[model samples]
Target: MTLVAIVLGAAVRPDGEASPTLRLRVEHAVALYHRGAVAAVCVTGGVGRHGPAEAEVAARLAMSLGVPERDVILEDRSRTTVENIAFARPLIGVHQVVLVSNRWHLPRAWVVARILGVRASVSGPRGRMSTSRTIAATLREVAALPSTVWRAWILSKRSAPKPEPRAR
Candidate 1:
């Protein structure tokens, strides 16, 4: 099976710089690649408050960390966890994805993946964020869970084919 590391998006500063969370996700994905755990790294995100898309930033970091350009797949048009998985699915094509994000973010991401009918595993950087940031992120995850699920449900419905009208 083709294994891919899906580096989920994080905040990019307004000046187009990567936030620590974004760097962490990309580093973990690159580590997985260097260790031969995955064949490609698919970074996902569209422009947020920043000028450059999160995926674009992560893709550049992945390359700078030794992941070849060809092995970096960029899905630079998704702004949420649901859209992240949804948008990246086609580009990822028949791969078992390993979602890479901060530890606090993986649960919702996994939920989004399962709702999208994508079988995915998750990996996070071993390093820990500062306590305040961790608490804040955890709370954010808790608050975002419902909306994430709702969006995933909507996306799944939209992507699902309508059954042919029963033979008239």
Candidate 2:
């Protein structure tokens, strides 16, 4: 199965540039593309306090870094990790995916993907943040875990087929 790198959006600067975290994610995906690990890179995120969507910024970065535009798919209407993978699934058009995000986020993302029945392998960028930023992000991820799972569960239930009512 061909693998697609699903680069989850982090944040975009108000100036419409990719955040450091976002850049790291996109760069990592591009590296994977160069290494011939993935057939394409699917960048996912919606507009968040910015004009261009997060995926757009990440896609541009990937293209600038030499990943061909034709090989970059965009899912530009997702505001969360669940939405990221969910929205990108059709665009990816493959069973195998590489979920790309920060180290702290990959665990939750992997869980959510599996719960949603997405066959995924997780990968984090080789990058570092300031101590304060790392601590803040770690705390945020810890707090987000339960809600993330709950949301994924809800979405999974919604997508599941409902049984037909038995005739009396």
Candidate 3:
């Protein structure tokens, strides 16, 4: 089966540079490619408060690291977790996916993948965020869990087809 790795992007720097978190995610995705576990890498995220689209930056980084150009699938329009998954679905054919993001962001990312009908597992490279930033992200994940779950449920229901009426 084809294995697609979804690498979630982080905020960019004011100089149009990738933050450490984004670099780590790109490294992780490239490592997966080197291991031959992932047939394709889907870079997901749009421009943050600064810099270019996260996916585009990530794709460039991956190419710089020797990942084949054709293997990098850019989902540059996604500005949120849900949008990432939704936008990536049509481009990725793999049901079993490996998601790459910051550790604090894994739970919500996984929820988004499930909402988009992907069976996924998550991994994060080392994080360099400050203590306060890490704590804030963790708290945000906790706060977002309820809505994420609810959205997943709603999405699943909507994707399921209706049964035909029974004849008397």
lDDT scores in order: 0.90, 0.91, 0.85
For model 3, residues 1-168, the per-residue Cα lDDT tens digits are 788899986888888878888889989989989999888899988988986998988899999999889999999988777777777877887688899888899988897777767899998887887999999989999998888778767776887679999999
Using lDDT as the measure, what is the rank order of every candidate, best first?
2, 1, 3
Cα-based RMSD of candidate 2: 1.9
Best by lDDT: 2
- The TM-scores, one per candidate, come to 0.93, 0.93, 0.87
Q: Residues 1-168, candidate 2: write the lDDT tens digits.
A: 799999998789989899888998999999999999999999999999876999999999999999998999999999999999888987888978999999888989999999888999999986598889888988998899899999999998998779999999
Candidate 1, residues 51-122, lDDT tens digits: the string is 699999889899999999999999999988898999999998964689999888899999999999999998
Candidate number that wins on TM-score, 1 or 3 = 1
Q: What is the alpha-carbon lDDT for the whole of candidate 3?
A: 0.85
